[model samples]
Each structure stands twice: as C-alpha cells, then as structure tokens.
Target: MGIRNKLDISAYFVVGPENTKGRPVAPIIRDAVDAGFTCVQIRSKTASARQLIELTGQASEVIAKTGKSDIVTLLVNDRLDVVLAAKKQGIKVDGIHVGQTDIPVDVCREYLGPDAVVGLSARTHELFEYIKNADVSLIDYFGAGPVHETTTKPDSGLDVDGKRITRSIEEITTLSRLSSIPVVVGGGVKLADIPSLARTGVAGFFVVSAISEADDPGHEAANLVKTWNSHKR
Candidate 1:
C-alpha cells in the first residue's frame, strides 16, 4: 500500500541449528514468542521439503496459539517452492526471506503471488543494485550485512570479526535511508552493539546464531528486542 511502515526493531529470529547442539527450532521459536520476539523466519538449508513443511506446521500452531500476527514468518534460505507450498497450505506465516542464490524476486512474485512478504539479502552494493528493479515491488525488506565476519555463514561475502559490524551498519543504514524499502542488519550482531546499530537508522535486523545458539536464546531474544526498542525512543 503506502510506503511500508518502519520495520520492528525488536528481535527477529533466524532458525538454523548451525550445528551447535542448540535447542530445536520449534521450542526455540516458542521461547522466542515467550520472550517477546516480534518476528521469526526459518532459515534452514539442510532440511528437505517434507521436513520444512513439518517444522513450519508446528511453528504455525505456535504463532496461532499465541495470536502473534506477523510474529512468525517462514523463510526458506533459498527455496521458493517450499515457501509457496507453505503459503498454499494456509500456513500462517508473515512471509518468506530469500538471498542471491534463490529465485529472482520477480519469478518469486509470479509464483508466490503478490502479497508475499519477500526479503532479499545483499552483501555488496552491486548485489543490492542487482535487485533494484526487483525491489520496486517484488521485495518487501532487505538484509544487508554480516557487518562483521561471522562463523554463521563463513563463505558469504560479508562478515568481519566484529570489526566490520560498525562499518556494515554504516553501509546498510546509508542504503536504508536512500531507499524506500526497509533495510535490516544481520551477521555478527552482539548484545552490546544493538544501540550503536539502532543509531545507524536501518529499520531492524535479522539475528541468526546470536539468538539461536545463545545460552538462553529466548532471553537473548528479549535483550536484543529491548535494546533495539530503547534506541528507538
């Protein structure tokens, strides 16, 4: 409709085990809800279609039981069909998040249909520009950073060992200010850095390992949300 509203600065969870023996995705999500996390996206790459459907089904229930509209968004790391199937099943999720390797935003829109809250990740400005035409309508929000090197996605372009977090924030904030779409920061975000990140002016963030693999993911989720909100006021 009108310019999309500013994104929620509260915690947004990304569901990937990251091989850390962390809590299962379902319970972690349940706890995320309990901890006041406003949004979630399942970002697993290893799970098959059947597995994802099963997982999202459980997540759907959690979202419904809690009455968390837009609280849970089912995002496939790079799978569009999974996203479409999740939608067709009437699985209640906010939307799907995708990245460079996934289907083009236009094709995703054609198949997933309008109204799907599609997100794209951009590590470099060129990659961001790659989706400029796509961003016109096909994309809803953009994830732009690992702001620092992260073990989370070691091979991806962005990620500096906590060193780049500020620079990444600077870059994405600049992008978000100029563009109409919301830009979110991800990768190597830490509890102490949330306020500085907020000062950058991006709408919000997508936290993966920081929340998922934390000693207390739910509590960690809450802290990030709290920190982000404090910065807003």
Candidate 2:
C-alpha cells in the first residue's frame, strides 16, 4: 500500500446519534454534509452485522452523492468481517476502529492490508501507558476519550464532560510528540468545545451527538468545521 491509495481522512462525523435517540439519521447526515463536513463516520451500536451492512450501504450512496473527500467509515469494535464486507462493495470506507477487546492491529492489517487505516481506542492513563509501550509498527491513529459520561457508550471512562477532552489532549499531545501517527479525540466533543480540543493538538475528533442531535445539523456542522479549522491553525 502506498500514500497515493491512502486517504487523509480527518474530520467531524455525525454518526448514529439520531437513530439511537429515536430520531431520523439520514436527514441529519445530509444536513451535516451540506453544512460543510467533509467526512462523516458511519457508526451504529445495537445493530447486527447484517443491519450494519445495509446501513453502511445506504450511507455510502448518500455520502457519494455529496462529493465529500475523506469518507472514513469505521466499525465501532474490531469487526474485520464487517469492514471487509463494506469494502467489498466498493464503499468509500477508509478505516476500522477497534476497542480494547478487539483484535490486535497486526491481524487487522493482515486482513485489510497496510493501506486501510486501523484506529485503536484508548481511554485511561493506564491504556495510554500500554499504547506507549507497544510496537508502533501495528497502529495508525489513536481514538482517545469518551471525554465525558455519554449515554452512547456506558462503559466509557471519565464521567465528567469536557474534562476528558483535557486528558485526551494531554495524552494525545504526548503520544503525537513521540509517535509518527496522529491521535483522534472522540466522545462528547460538542461544537462549542472543539476549539479548546484543537488547541490541545489532537489530530481530529469522532463526534456523534453534537452533529446528530444539533438543532440545525448543517449550521452545527459548519460551526464545527469552522471552529476546528481556526483553532488547529
């Protein structure tokens, strides 16, 4: 795999929050993309593998029609089968995210190859220690933080909102300084809070509720993009 085949997939994503909260998701995704989100991660918990495949297929069409660049769709857990299924359909998915219990990075890469990205979730300081000690050959980017007590994933660490961002920022800053890859901060990253997080030198974020539940997803997405852009620079 080479750089030419790889995608620079770093952006705000509105994923699954609408349907998870009993609201429609398609319109929200459409609005979010219209609002200026270049990429949106398609993540849905509680759905079976079959259901997820169908959902990703539908989402693939919507995103393809919009002409956004980095459509880095990811599976929540380390489900290589699902990722392969989605990729087999020629979908624009560029990455797959794995949790603590998911398969290790080497196996995922062997199945998906070196080109497709693999995102590892790291929440606690102890987990950060492990990531720091592990061989950097397997991983690509780090998805750090629930950054808050979110109803989305109950098992997540740190119940305090915004504070997780601080911890994730501190960790990712240190990790980024040491590693060649980037670190992405996920969980409870509100549109209003992106600026603070960007200042922490996080590579990007994985957001669901903020864009999925915003009053105006389009404007909310525009705000998220504009804010992150200004802050990152």
Candidate 3:
C-alpha cells in the first residue's frame, strides 16, 4: 500500500537482455530512467535465475545512479523468486509483475508483504470477468493489451479463440472506467499511440522494443514520457 499510493506509472519501461538487441541492459535502463520512465519491469524468457539476479542488481545500480531512484520503481516480471533473491541480496527491487499464468497475486502480496506492488495481466475478453471475480484488494494494478502485434511478446493478449487481440482505445477507456485498479497498456505500443492511450484515462502505458530497440533509448523514452504527460488525465 505504501508504494501503490504514490506510484508514478506514467512511463513504464519493460526491458531485459532479450529485449535489448545485443546491447547491455543496464545502460538502457539508465537511459530510460534518466529520460523519465517512472517504472521498470525486468523481464526475460531465457535467462537463468542466477543471471536474472545479477542483471537485476545491475539494473538497480543504474537506477540509483540516476538520482531519481526515490521516484522510480523497479519490478521483476513473473518472478517472485527473483524479487525475493534480489531483496535478500540487498538490491532495491520494488515488487513483482505476474502474468495470468505466473505466480498468483495473493501469493505475491503475501510473500512480498503489504508494501510491495503487485500487478496482474489480463486480456480483453476476460477483463470484465476478472474485475468482478478477482480479489481487487490484492492487486495494485492491471497490465493489459497489445495495441498492435509484437514480436517481443508474440502471444500477448491472445483470446480464448487463440487469435491475437488488439485492444481498441474505446475498450481500454471502458476498462479503465470500470476497474478500481490502475491499468497500464503495452505490447507493440508506439509513439503515435501514447497521446490517445493517455487520454483513455489509464494509469499509464508501457513499452518494450519501442525503447529497448530504439536508436536513441533515452531520447525515445523522453518523448514517450513527454507525450504521455501532455495528454494524461
């Protein structure tokens, strides 16, 4: 509850060794945070636990160096074990972001304690049902969408029919209005989508390759932040 009340999710950057194109992840994290990304999720599908722990440590160091560590939040994607290991090692990771199939939200909240921020992912078809059935008090926010198709997370937002679902601005707006938890949209999100997405009254928008694979990560991150700020409610 502590971090959730003050969480600034305006520009959330999701990055990892896989997201960066043969580039060092720490520098990219540094650039994104320096450029105004308020939250970061360390996600990877290939790295081992020890490697993730090391990378999380490196990312924490860079965020701290930016001098905005107090305002910026760092989280691990789908890995409560990594979050625990990182914290045990003295790295300042803020919380965990789990997918529908990942560790359960209550387990995450129980393990991380009341202060930790726990995020859950949901697709459009299930969005309403989830809101009605889920213990909303256990989750701090919802991560929804693939505004467009993306290779970074190829199967994101796939519906029960197994078809890729691109959430429309209208659907997003409605979800934001209906849910009590903050919602952050991502998956193939581009610079052009920021203004409209921000105006949808979502807590924020997140990106993967948009910044991680950009020619100038910092400049791109800054522009995303600026676009969001210009239209955010």
Candidate 4:
C-alpha cells in the first residue's frame, strides 16, 4: 500500500532517536505499534547517514514482525537520502518529514513520487498560510507546534520576546478546518494535556519526551493512545 493510504494520520504520533534516554528504537517502535500509534518519525539528528539507515532498518523490522507494517507509517526526519538508502537496502521507510530549512516539499514529492508521505512543520501563522497555498497533492500532513516549551528539539519553542511562536489552539483549529490534509500538533505534550489538546480537533498529537523519557515507554505510549482514543469516544 502507498504511504498515504496506509497512514492513519489521526492516530497517535511518536518521534525520537535510536537510543532515547537508554531506550532502543526497535523496542520503542514495537511498543508504540502495540499501543496503537500509527505513525513514527525517526529523528536522529546527530547520527550519521549509515547509522540512521541501520536504525530505521531495525525499526522497519519491528513493525513488519508485529504485523503492523501495512498500518504503521515510518518516516525519516529531514533525510530523503536516508529514506532512499534504506529502500535500496530492503527497508520500507514510508517517507520524510522536513522543516522550512530542509528540502522543499515539492522537491521531496518529485523525488519520492506521489505515494510517499511528506510532512512539513508549520510553527507560525505565516508558515501555515504558506502551507495553505502549497500543493496539497504532494503533502500528507502538517506538523504544528511546540504547543508548550519543549526540550526534545533544541530549536523548538518561543523567540526573544517571550511569545509562543508555535501555533495556538485557535490557529490549529483554523488550519485543521481550512487545510485538506491532516494537522498533527507536537512539543511538550503530556498525558494531562491530551484531553485539552484533543479538543482542538487536530488529527492527532506528536510526542517525544513524554514517551522517550518515561521509565516504561510501552506503558507511557499505551496511556497516551488510550487518552487520545477516549477523546474520540
């Protein structure tokens, strides 16, 4: 199946490193899949290309072995080359997630073709407006946040004036309603915040430290998924 078709964008989303606070990527992915997270983005910023490919390959194996390969979509953050490299090595990575400074979304679509999942980060209204005019056919989803201050991504959060630079709930709601693609919110999203975030009507939530730093990633993921699911009920 195509990545676009396979992805349940409304489900829980998880982003992390190969070794998150001593937790390995493979088991974390397994736990995520079992806990009903439908999307995983491998964001190993400091790892080399070979290391990323190897790590993603392991994650792909876990997804495949657990029989969630068709349902779960795995993406490599800002590394289209790694995604292509992994494919050549027989690892099934779904696509790439890019920031404004990364490759243009259209270029990514041209390289990966229509079926590849392309996610772009929209932290400001201006960025969201730009995304609104973007070619929806080439994009899968929009990742909007650091809903609160976050340490997961060193570059995330507010600017010099102490303003919340990321999209607010009102902005998210407007974007969710206006855009054709799904919108997933991220950054500093904890279990206690899920209920309120869910009310914003985003397709889903993106998590990192909340799960990666937990002593039990599986349980943490399960709780997150459960909370997300409850909102739909």
On TM-score, the candidate that comes out on top is 3
Winner of 3 and 4 under TM-score: 3
List where candidate 1 sits over 4 angstroms from the true fold. 1-10, 19-22, 70-72, 123-135, 158-166
TM-score of 4: 0.91
lDDT of each: 0.68, 0.65, 0.89, 0.80
The deviation in Å at residue 176 for candidate 2 is 3.5
TM-score per candidate, chains pooled = 0.84, 0.82, 0.96, 0.91
lDDT of 1 by residue, 1-233 (tens): 31123335346777765533655777777777777776677767677887887777777788677776553454566677776677788876555777766777788778766656778876453544553544456787777776667777765553334323334555666676666776777777788878888887777766777777878877888888888888953
Residues 69-158, candidate 2, lDDT per residue (tens digit)?
Answer: 344343434567777888888865665778656777878888888777677776464555766676767777677776666766656664
Candidate 3 global TM-score: 0.96
Worst 10 residues of 4 by lDDT: 10-19
RMSD of each: 3.8, 3.8, 1.3, 2.1
Query: Hey, what RMSD does candidate 1 come out at?
Result: 3.8
lDDT over C-alpha atoms for residue 33 of model 3 = 94
Candidate 2 stretches with Cα past 4 Å from truth are 1-6, 17-20, 69-77, 158-172
* TM-score quality measure for candidate 1: 0.84
| lDDT, model 3, position 94 | 90
- The most accurate candidate by lDDT is 3
Winner by TM-score between candidate 3 and candidate 2: 3
lDDT of 4 by residue, 69-108 (tens): 8888889999989999999998998899997779988999
* lDDT: the better of candidates 2 and 4: 4
**Each candidate's clash count:** 6, 0, 0, 0
